[model samples]
Target: MKILFLDQSGKPGGAELCLIDIAKPYRDRALVGLFADGPFKTLLQQNQISVEVLTTQSIQVKKSSSFLQGLKSLRQIIPLIIKVVKRAKGYDLIYANTQKALVIGAIASFFARRPLVYHLHDILSKEHFSQTNRRIAINLANYFASLVIANSQASQTAFVQAGGRANITTVVYNGFEPKIYQTCESDVRQLQQELGLIGKFVIGHFSRLAPWKGQHILIDALAKCPQQVTVILVGDALFGEQDYVQQLHRQVTALGLKNRVNFLGFRADVPQLMAACDLVAHTSTFAEPFGRVIVEAMLCGTPVVATKAGGAMELIEPGINGFLVQPGDFQELAQVITTCLHERHKTATMAHNARKIASQHFDVKIINQQISQLLSSKFN
Candidate 1:
C-alpha cells in the first residue's frame, strides 16, 4: 500500500527515529515529506526511503515561551500543507509522525479522503505544552484525525485527559533501531578511548539536554555512586537551554564530579557508545513518553537502570532485563548502580536477557507489520 509519512523535524531525535518505523512498510511505494531537511533526510535516503523537503524555513522555538513561536511555525508550514494535499491524493493513508505533522497531514488527509493516523510522540499534558497548545491538540484530534497512535501509555492517557477520543487511540511503543546495535564484539574500544571509560564503570544518560529529560538528576545520582563510576552524558542542548547546561557544570564542579562526569554532546555513533558503557541510565523525573536509549542499550546487550515511572516500567522488568529505580530517588539509583557494577555475572545475564527481549518486541519488523495491518484494515 502507498503511504505518505510526514515528520516536521530535520534532526534525528526520538520522534524522527520512530518515523523510520512508520515509513518502513512503504520504502518502495511511499514518499516521506519533511518540513526542513537536514541529516534525517540523508538517513531516510540511505535506507532507500523517498523523502521530500517542503519548507527550507526553520524556526528555533525555545521552551520559555513557545506560543508565539508555534504560531510562526504554523504560518510558515502553510505552503507545506498545500504541497502535501496536492501530493497526498495517490497515497492510501496519511501517517503523521509528530504533532505539527498531524496538524498538517490531518488537513491533507481530509483534502485527499485518505485515513489519517496521528502518531502522537509528544504527550499533550501541560508539562510539555502550554494549556492553549493542549486545547488546540485536543480540538484537532477530535475534528480531523481518524486515529491516534501513541508512543507510550502516558501519552495516550494524557491525550484522553485532554479530551481526545480514547477508543481511537492505540499505544505503540517507540521502537529501537536495533540493526545499528546488534553486533558481536564491536570495536567499542574506540569509544572507551575517546570518552575515557577504560578503568572506570560508565553510566550513560543519552538524550537531548532538555529540562524535562532530567540530565541534572542523573548528575545528582552520580554523586552517590562509587568514585570509580563515571557518568557519560550524550546529546546537545535543545531549544537553547544553555543556562541549565551551565548550571549542571557548576553542580558537577561543586560535587567534585568534574573529573568523574564527561559530556559527550551529540554523538552520531550512539550504538558504539552504548556498547562501551557498563550500564545505561534513564533518569527523566517526568514521565519519558518512551526511553529510546533504554531499548537501544538493551539491543546492544547492556543492562539498564531506569525510573519506574512512564514507559520505562512498560519496557523494563526490574531484576529481569534491567533494574527500575523510583523516579528521582538517588539512593535507590545509587544502590542499583552499585549492584550492577559489583555483580558482573548477574549484570551480564540481564544484558543477555535484555537483548533477547528487545529483539522480540522492539524490532522495526514488528512496527512495519502493525502499520501495514492498520492501514489495510482502514483502507479495505
Candidate 2:
C-alpha cells in the first residue's frame, strides 16, 4: 500500500529515530516527508527510505497569549498546507508521526480523501501542554483523526481522557535496530578516554536537554553519589529550552560537579555510548509518553534506573531488570544508583534479562510485522 509519513520535527529525537523503523518496512512504497532537513533526514536516507523535505512545513506551531499572533502564523502556513494536501493525493493513507504531523496530515487527509493515522507520542494534559494547546489538540484529534497510535498505554489513556476516541486508538511501543546500534570495542575505549572516565563508573542520561528531562535533578543525585561515579549527559536542546540548558550548566557548576559531569551533546552513536556507560538514567521530572532510551539500553544489555513516570513502569521490572525512582527525588535516585553500583555481580544478570525482554517484545523485526499486519487489515 502507498503510505505518506509526516513528521514536523527538525531534530532527531527518540520519536524521530523510532519513526525510521516505522517507515523502513514500507520503504518500497512509502514516502517519508519531513518538515525540514536535519540528521533525521540523513538517517532515513541511510535506511534506504525515500525522504522529501517540505521546507514550508513549520515545526513551531506558534504558541502565544495573543490569539491574533497564533492566527497570523496559521495564515502564513496556509500555502504550505495547500501544498501538503495536493501532495497527499497519491497516498493510500497518511501516517502522522507526531502531533504537529497530525495537524497537517489530518488536514491533508480531508483534502486528499485518505485516512489519517496519528502517531501520538506525548501525553496531552494541562501539565504537559499549555491550556490553549491542549484544547486545540483535542479538537483537532476528535475532528480529523481516523486512528491514534500511542507509544504507550499510558499515553493512550491520556489521549482518551482528553476526549480522543478510545476505540480508534492502539498502543505501539518503539522499536530499535539492535545491529545498527551495536558498539565496537575500540570506539568504547575511545569514548571512555574522551570523557576522562578511565576508571569511573558512568551513569548516562540519554535524551533531549529539555527542562522536564530532569538534567538538574540528575546533577543533584550525582552530588550524593560516590566519588568514583560520573554523570554523562547525551543529547542536545531540541526546543526553546535553551534557558533550562543554561540553568542546568549553572546548577552543575554551583553544585561543584564540573569535574564529575560531562555534557556529550547529541551523538548519533547512542548504542555505543550505552555500551560504554555503567548505568543508564531516565530522569524525567514528569511523565514521558515512552522511554525509548530505557528500551535501547536494555537492548544493548545495559541496566537502567528511570523515574516512575508514564512508560517507566512498563519498561522496568524494578530491582529485576532495572530500578525506578520517583521523578525529581534526588535522594531516592542516589540510593538506587549506590545499590546498583554495589551490586555489580547482579548487573550483568539484569542486563541479560533486559535483552530477553527486548528480544521478546521490543525488537524492530517483530514490531514492524505487527504494524504492517495492522495497516494491511485495517488501513488498506
Candidate 3:
C-alpha cells in the first residue's frame, strides 16, 4: 500500500529514527514528507528512502502554548496543510509520526479522503505537554485518525488518561536492527582509547540534552559514584535547550567531575560508542514514552540502568535483564551503577539476557511484520 509518512522534525530524534525503520518496508511505495529540512532528510536519503521537505517555516506552537497561541499558529500552517492535502492524494494512507505532523496530516487526510494513522511517540502527561496542547492533539486524533499507534503501553495509558479513545489505539514498541549495534572489538577498543576511557567504568547517556531528559541527573549520579566510574554524554541539545546544556556544564564543574565526564555532543557512531561503554544510563526526570537508548544499548550487549517509569519498566526486568531506579533519584541511580560496576560477572550475564530479549521482541523484522499486518488489516 502507498503511504505518506509525515514528520515535523528537521533533526533525527527518537520518533524520526523509529520512522526510518517503520517506513523501510514501504520504501518503494511510500514517501516521507518532512515539515522542515535538515540532517534528517539527508539521513533518509542516505538510506535510499523517498523523502521531501514539505515546509520551510517552523511551527510556532509549543507544548505550553495557550489556546489563543495555538489558534494564531494554526493560521501560519494553512499553506502547509494545503500542500500536504494536495500531495497526500496519491497515497493510500497518511501516517503522522509526530504531534505537529498529526495536526496537519489529520486535516490533510480529510481533504485528501485517505485514512489517517497517528503514531503516538510522547507521553501525554502534564510533565511533558500543556493541557491546551494535549486537548488539541486528542480531539484531532479522535475526530480524524483511523488508528493511533502508541510506542509503548505507557504511552497508550497516558493517552487514555488524557481522554483519548482506547479502542482506536494499539501499542507498538520501536524496532531496531540488532546487527547495526554489533561493533567490532577493534572498533570498540579504538573508540575507548581515543576517548581516554580505557580502564574506566564508563556510563553512557544517549539522549538529547534537555532538562526533562535529565543529563544533570546523570551528572549528579556520576558525582556520587566511585572515582573509577566516568560518564560519556552522547547527544546535543535540540529544541532550544542550550541553556540546559550550559547548566549541565556548571553542575559538572560544581561537583568537580571535570575529568570524569565527557560531553560527546551528537555523534553518528552511537552503536560503536554504546559498544565501548561498560554500562548505559537512562535518567529522564519525567516519564519517557519509550527509551530508545535503553533498547539500543541492550542490542549492543551493554548493561543498562534506566529511570523506573513509563516504558522503561516494560523494557527492563529488575535484577534479571537490566536494572531500573526511581526517576530523578541520583542516590538510587548511583547505587545501581555501583552494583553493576562491582559485580562484573553478574552484569555481563544481565547484558547477555538483555541482548537476547531485545533481539527476540524488538527486532526490526518482527516489528515491521506487525506494522505490515496492521496496514493489511486496515486495507482489507
For the record, the alpha-carbon RMSD of candidate 2 to the native fold, in angstroms, is 1.8
User: How does model 1 score by TM-score?
Assistant: 0.92
lDDT of 1 by residue, 245-326 (tens): 8988999999999999899898878888888889998888778788888999999888899988777888888778999887
Q: All candidates' TM-scores?
A: 0.92, 0.94, 0.98
Q: Over the stretch 1-380, how does candidate 2's per-residue lDDT look in tens digits?
A: 89999998666777888888899878999998888888778889998999998864454454332345456567656766787787788888989897667778878888888888888888886668766766677777778887778889889988889888888888888887777656788999998898788899889999889888888888999999999989999987866778888998999999899999998897778888998988999999989888888888988888899999798888889768888999899999999888878988788789889878877888889888878887887875
On residues 1-380, what C-alpha lDDT tens digit does candidate 3 reach at each position?
99999999998888999999999888999999998999999999988899999888888988888889888887679999999999999999999999999999999999999999999999999988899999989999999998999999999999999999999999999999989998999999999999999999999999888988888888988888999999999998888899999999999999999999999988989999999999999998878999999999999999999999999999999988999989889998989989988999999999999999999999989999999998899765
User: Residue 201 of candidate 3: its Cα lDDT?
Assistant: 96
lDDT scores of the candidates, listed in order: 0.83, 0.83, 0.93
> Candidate 3: where is the Cα deviation over 4 Å?
none
What C-alpha lDDT, on a 0 to 100 scale, does residue 358 get in candidate 3? 96
Model 3 local distance difference test score: 0.93
Query: RMSD, each candidate, Å?
Result: 2.2, 1.8, 0.9
Ranking by lDDT: 3, 2, 1
Clashing pairs for model 1 are none
Locate the minimum summed-lDDT window of 10 residues in model 3.
Answer: 67-76
